[model samples]
Target: MILWGRPSSVNVQKVLWALSESAVPFDHHIVGGKYGGTDTATFKVMTPVPRVPVLQDGDLTLWESHAILRHLAGGVPPLADQWMEYTTSTLQPAFLQMFYELVRTAPADRTKDAEALKATFLAAVAPLEWQLRKTQWLGGDSFGMADIAAGAMMVRACDLCDPLSPQVARWYEQLQTRPAYRAVVMTSYEELRA
Candidate 1:
């Protein structure tokens, strides 16, 4: 099995963390976005959308982070379709909005509109805070795809979202305690941070 994407991307991080949690062994082919290399015809053929974190396993190919997570979670304990919905329906949009706020805006614009962006991010977190308060994991006590999806944002919130909520902070802290998540972050991100 192979996963293609730059390690720094939050979308790509979702799949890598899932692979770690599942203890699935696979090779990673660095590609896409800032890391570039998406110009290749072969890479484009693998993912119709030509996006990062495309998964190729034997004869199968998949793209979209949530969809890839669902495919990888097949029959895995405590991760199922509903968890995928939690990712797509609940997490992805808000996360993407936050990502755009940080990545697509100029620093001057962000400074001028900090309050608005913060409000948007805060509003986005309310439901997540509510859901998290109800369960240790997004899927209610078991770490699964929902947690993986949300956790991806949680990892990047300090950069993407402003005035991170206490609830969100606690949730991220809890997630970081997981050995699998720690392994993925350490292997994929910490070294780069160094």
Candidate 2:
């Protein structure tokens, strides 16, 4: 299997992190966003929407970060599967909205549009925070795909925003300890820095 996308992208990051956690071995091709070396003709055929994080496994081509995540989690635990859907369908939109505002708008404009977006994210994040307070991981106890989905976004938010909730901070710290999470993020960070 092969995955394509710039790792810095939250969507891309989610997929990469999940791949790292899975037992499967795959190649990661850095493309899209700033890397800018993707083959448009081939990419367009694979993904009609022209999004990042496209996965190719033999004859199967998959797009959308969340969908790719689900595909990767095929035989994983039930909680992992359930929370992956929940976070992708429910939590990620608000997070993405806030990210779009922050990255696309100027600081001055951030006050009006981005602040509203951020506030919406804060509201969205609260329930997850409450849920985490009760469970060690999003998928019950063990680290699984659901935790990868939520953790990918949670780590990105923590990077951009100051003073994340205590529960979130601890969770993020735990994620750092995971070799898979560290490998994906650090590899991406190093390549981006280069």
Identify the candidate with maximal TM-score. Answer: 2
In the predicted model 1, the residue pairs found to clash are none
Off by over 4 Å in 1: 75-90, 108-112, 160-167, 183-194
Clashing pairs in model 2? none
Candidate 2 versus the native: TM-score?
Answer: 0.82
TM-score of each predicted structure versus truth: 0.80, 0.82
Cα lDDT computed for each candidate against the true fold: 0.71, 0.74
Give the least accurate 10-residue stretch of model 1, judged by summed lDDT. Answer: 185-194
Predicted candidate 1 versus true structure: per-residue lDDT over 1-194, tens digit per residue: 89999877778888999988878899999987657777798887887676798899899999888878878878434534565565577556766665565665555565435556556666766766776677776677777777787677665555545535566667778888988777664343332331
Q: What lDDT is reached at residue 29 by model 2?
A: 82
